[model samples]
Target chain A: MSATYTAAATLPEALAALASGARPVAGGTDLVVGARQGKAPLPDSLVAIHGLAELRGIAETGGGGLRIGALVSHADLVAHPAVRERYTALADASAIVGSHATRHVGTLGGNVMNASPAMETGGPLICFGAEAVLVSESGERRVAVADLLTGPGRTAARPDELLVAIELPAAAGGSCYARLEYRRQMEIAVVGATCAVTLEGARIGSARVAITALTPRIVRVPDAESALAGGDGGAGAVQAAGDAAAAAAQPISDVRASADYRRAMAAVIARRAVTAAIARARGSSDSVPIPASPALHGADRD
Target chain B: MRYDAVLNVNGTDFPVEIEPHRSLLSVVRTELGMPGSKEGCDDSECGACMMLLDGRPVNSCSYLALQADGRKIVTVEGLADGGELHPLQRQFLAQGGVQCGFCTPGMLISAKALLDQNPAPSEDEIRIALSGNLCRCTGYQGIVRAVQAAAAEIA
Candidate 1:
């Protein structure tokens, strides 16, 4: 319970406090685990930035786009009206995160900064072409979501800078996030995928696909998108995309899943994610990886 | 250094002081005399320390009292009204949701929040809601049944 000044009025104050080497705690969902696990550095100081009014909203950018504050909790993202309408997959993905209690405290910015390689939000945000607003004592700069994550459980954000908000551009059609997990919740990702499609007449105007948790960082499967774009999204389109995604993956063996198993899971998740995105683009809510219990995946509980 | 805090447990508010680095569980149990919320893991892995903040379930052991300042706090001690157990508590007892009962309060609050939002949850939803809280005894059938029974009663 060691304390530091908890002033959270503005971003400048957070930046000034960062100069004193305080751990910036937002959401406190993931960081709390680190602290409880004795994995976090002893807090020379602490800065509570959850109350900065400037960093807490999901609103339209006056041009039919969306900007989500860094402090926006997963619960808010899942329930927000604007996010529901514009980025339904993002909302759906947020809804299925960890657990109900964890979602209430976990923030989008925390996930982005945490840069967990298997993060559910990263695939959706990157596939949707989201931009992050990072602020420091120097100034503010925007970086693409894909460029932000540097490694597993890591990010490119400077220690002195804090991510403030994320911006998603306007687009046609809808997107969907799909994941395959060994357990229902509280477990890390096995394989995750995001598919966003822009429609033009009956032809595919654009397609974006991103995969994470199986790779070192969130990897954009351009080959999958190109295969979908150059070829027809008919019976063979998904198979081609899945093939490209498998080829694109550079997954290594991990305790969660073997590289071999992850390769297969990646193909499955990619195919399902693309199919769901297409269904969503055609205006349907029947997609997304809806799991069934009683007969669950992975091993049985201890 | 000692950190001063005000803990609102059950229905009463108490003024207390503790080490700057002590956990909220310490203040609630040792100082405020409310021990319904057990500390199973001191770490976040175990849900033995679950409680409600503004009615949402959270791991109290993972937090500091300062985090709940001027906020509504509810604990297992407050789940009952005038010595009457909440419906979930009664159902848990009758349905054998308690084996060792170490994880009961955390499981109860987690299930309560789900039932509060979705009165008729599917089996998968019930499992997802309770994933954060773990129980070694009873194999979870009784806990799942209790939550389903609570949902049925509320519905």
Candidate 2:
């Protein structure tokens, strides 16, 4: 049980609380739920930062990118027009995060800091080359999203530091995030993949492929990207990229699926993501829905 | 250690001292003496403890009571206005949405939250909105029908 609690009204106050060894709670979805599940007890000293107004809103940067506050909820991201148009992969990932309630309260900062390998937004953030702005009492520093996430349920950030915002570079072309799930709502990814490709006329200019729930940390697959880049973005290239993703997967057996099953499904999910991303890049945006998992499943029948 | 805070629940203020780890569901039920919201699962997986915090649906089971200080909260008991039952309540009964009454409060709260934001929701939208609330007794067809009926009544 926690012995102390302080609801910080400002950013500096929250940072000071963190500097004083108080764990920050935003939305409390993961921290409180993890406590109930016996994964970890509530922190001895807690600071509620949900009331900090400075840590809210999504603003367009001068460089045509986005500067998303830590308190920006998944629901907000899904409803943002820029996210739907320019960052479709992020929209696809955030649209399917938990139920309506979870999306309403679960913030992007909480999700990124949680560092779950199977988290919906991690793959897309990595593929977009996002950066995490960590604020401390003394100073602020930015780290690439790929490097900030050290492992599952762990981050490279110190306890005294707070992740204030995520910075995304200007994006072009199309991207998609597709996950394998048993049910629609309140489900974690069994195996997932995010593919972002920029087309250069008839050929693929560049591609980034990241696999989720198939490794200790969500990481880009260089072999998979190499197979897709400089290709004609055809079925054969997509299939080869999928196969390379499967070859790079190092999964673990859990209640969701066996390691072998996850490895096998990695190729399928990766292929679906690649196919949908290519379709979007080709201006057939309606080919796949915002949340592409169910649409991809529906397409399997057709 | 406990902290003194006030929860503005259903337009009424209830000042109480609560522990930092206590959830809003427990504080609402135990301190405020309102048992309308049931605790099906202490974890957030089950939405039996759903409530509207500042007009947004939240799983009270996982929401810290202290964080809700000075915030408006609406539980199932607050759905009806005085003597007359809310349209959602009446429609839920008319559509046979209630079974064992275990998931009724949560379903009502979730439906109310949906209709407040989206006054006219499609059947698929209602289903997606209430996906957090689970009811094993009714196969969810009746609940879906109830939400649809209530939406029409309100519209």
Candidate 3:
């Protein structure tokens, strides 16, 4: 527990801290836990950015989009009315990230930057076409969330470039996120899907499907998009979309689940998510069917 | 190197110098001697180190003490009003919610947060609120009942 700690009071101070070799800490739900688990030692210089109110709330962009600060926690996202009303998928993903305690401390910026293949936020961010705003002493850059990930536990962000905010473009459709977990709490996704659907009358105008835990990283399934385009938002098209998503997944066998099971669940979850998203888009349903917790029984019980 | 910061806990501020690697829970228990918040898991897995950071329940073990500067924290020790216990504590004791007492602090804090938001929470809401605070003892029957009982009394 011996390391330098600097609490930055302003944006420029934070950038200076970053430039001076201090690793930014927001929430520290991942970094602190990772350190304790011996994943890595605490950085020699730590910059505490949680005190920066400038980097902490959800705001509206001039372009009818949403700007989520880098320090915004998962709990904040779930409770925000804008997030719930506009980006329900982000709210859904935020609600089930770890437990209430972890969610209270885990920030959306942290989740995205963690770049875990099974990270709950990535799928929805990719599906919604969110952009990450990276800032440093030299200036700022915005990168599409889809292109932010280089690999597992890695991002394209430079060490000096701190993620300051995530900007999500306004969506014409309704979107929802679903993750398949074994336990009710503190369980990572076995497979997850986030779907956004824009309906032109009864036919799908456009659809975006992103799957998680079924590959090295959360990825959009273009095949599913192809299947969903121009088709009526009906059972048949939805099922085919799911099938395409399953076909696109490159899941590997792991301790959490089998490659075969993940691939199959990816399809089922995609179907359910897309179906629900379409319902929300058409204004038929105000409620999303994503379970807040694990079902009481297992697959074998039934 | 170390950081000098003021941790506002239970309506009182304590000035301390701590390393960046040190957790808020460590500072609370070791430096301030408020051991009410137990450390069940050094990671965020267990909620034994749960505390209210700005009235929201968070795992203090994974929270850096320096990050808590200027933020108000409420630990289990702060839940009592001098000799009188908070309603959650009273109900927890009355309903036998305490078994090993490790998860009690976290359960109480999380319950407080839930009640703060929704005074009349449903049974399902209570379960979801305390989902982070695991209890290996009492089957969670007592804890759930205690929260329900408290909510009814307050209502």
Best by TM-score: 2
Alpha carbon lDDT at A93, candidate 2: 88
> Lowest summed lDDT over 10 consecutive residues: which window, candidate 2 chain A?
A287-296
TM-score of each: 0.91, 0.97, 0.94
What does candidate 3's lDDT look like per residue over B1-155, in tens digits?
77788999999999998877788999999999999999997777778889999988889998888888878999999999999888889999999898999899999999998999899998878987788888889899999999999888878
lDDT of 2 by residue, A36-111 (tens): 9999899989999998888899999999999999999999999998987788889888888887778888999999
Best by the DockQ measure: 2
Candidate 3 has which clashing residue pairs, if any?
Answer: none
Please give, for residues A1-302, the per-residue lDDT of candidate 3 as tens digits.
Answer: 45677778899999998998789888888788888989888898888787788888888999888999988988889888878777888888888888877887788989999889998889889988999999999999999999998788889999888899999998777888888886666777888998888888878999999998887878999989878888887878889989988998999898888999988888888887787788778875444336633245221200
TM-score for candidate 2? 0.97
Q: Score the docking of each candidate (DockQ).
A: 0.55, 0.77, 0.72
Per-residue CA lDDT of model 1 for B13-112, tens digit only, reads 7777665445667678887778888999876666778888778877778666666655677878888888888889999999999988899988988888
Top model by lDDT, which number? 2
